[model samples]
Target: MYQPRKRGYRKDNATLRWSLPDRVFFACGACHILAYAFLERWGTPGMQALWIRPAAGQTGNHVFVDGGDWVFDYHGYANRPQFLAHVWRGARRRWPGWDATLVPLPRDVLISEQKSRGYDGLWLREPGQFLHDAMPRANAYLDRFRAPAVRTAR
Candidate 1:
């Protein structure tokens, strides 16, 4: 049985190990590659633009996304009900009118059916596709969230 971590646990440990330039470059490059791949699959973004950071002590601290009604888990896909009930209880309260039937990703239908007995989500054939699709929007959101850096002429 998998137990979720307590609420308000720190999902990320921000240590200033990498230089700002390094972090920015790495993030941009990664997002570019992902965006390219995602565009190849879905053509245009069809999912809702939301990012969900996994809880501490859960999977590798990877950021999840609400790809429309489905929660794109790196390991699998979580249905809307499951996502609301377990992962992020506040979502429903936040988006009251956002309602969509939870459907498994086409490729993961079989696996999802099996896992549905125990878990509230399913696995996708390529979960990255979903994540990549959501990246460009997420990147933009992150950019706005991060403060602009000040530079002085040498």
Candidate 2:
């Protein structure tokens, strides 16, 4: 069983303890960054980044790529229904007071948030160091599903 871990724990305290594979697939709590990487790697024009939140001004927001029929997250690609059910159930189990809802995430807003949070430049520049195994994990997950055809010509 994988549980999400708090971000920014100190190294001397042994806070960054998960194995590479576990950090990539289950924990790390950096879904917004990973979601953007996944979008860059496999997103079609029809797909967009979205945040799942309980409501306005709430914590525990989750980010993932949303294709019309499918979604890609730390768990990899899955049909929309299964993804929603999984998120809803998991969220409810984790936080009994909130209900999850999908919210649109404009690219600009995402970039701004990333920048404000001190991740914008660092993540891309030193992805392996900042987010070990993310790209490789994304590639492996993507291998399980055929890439969506480009919905529109560039």
Candidate 3:
């Protein structure tokens, strides 16, 4: 199981390293087949955003997170869920607390991808990057809850 990082994902470990994707194995007298899965961060920006948004809104500050997204898989239409879970697992290994929601993209994105080549991707938005965008908005959002931090800290 992946743990939450107090801060955010480490660039060195954005890829999910787990062998299996998010799965739900069942035992009911029946056949067995690899089933589809949809991985979730379990926890998400809501909690962080919850605490910071209020402060940023009140202070009229900007918020942003800085980092790059790891390309786990693209156009692997058959294994979309597994690919995402893999990235999630990899991310967990690097930053246990970085519970950034690896939520599924809209169904339309998937459907379109299946039709052609879709950009099945993981938006590994580092907390630091978010602060970057938020700063201008006066959102005042940053990974550093106490003393504000610079992007180079990571």
State the lDDT of candidate 1 residue by residue for 1-154, as single tens digits: 1222334423132222111232232232122222232333332245422323233223311123345555433223467567657534343344443332333222222213343233233222222333233344434434433221223459
Considering every candidate listed, which one attains the maximal lDDT?
A: 2
CA deviation > 4 Å runs, candidate 3: 1-75, 102-154
- Estimate candidate 1's alpha-carbon lDDT, on a 0 to 1 scale: 0.32
lDDT at 25, model 2? 41
Question: For residues 1-154, could you state the per-residue lDDT of candidate 3 as single tens digits?
Answer: 2232324433333232111121210011000100001111111222111000111112111112211221111111224355446545664565564444322233222213242134322122222333232112221111112321223534
lDDT of 2 by residue, 1-154 (tens): 1353546554233335333354444334456555666677776567898767555444455677888887877776789999788777776677686675676675444434344345222221223434354446545555666665555647
What C-alpha lDDT does candidate 3 achieve relative to the native structure? Answer: 0.23
Ranking the candidates on lDDT from highest down gives 2, 1, 3
Candidates in order, TM-scores: namely 0.26, 0.61, 0.20
Q: List the candidate 1 regions with Cα displacement exceeding 4 Å.
A: 1-40, 53-62, 89-154
In terms of lDDT, which candidate is stronger, 1 or 2? 2
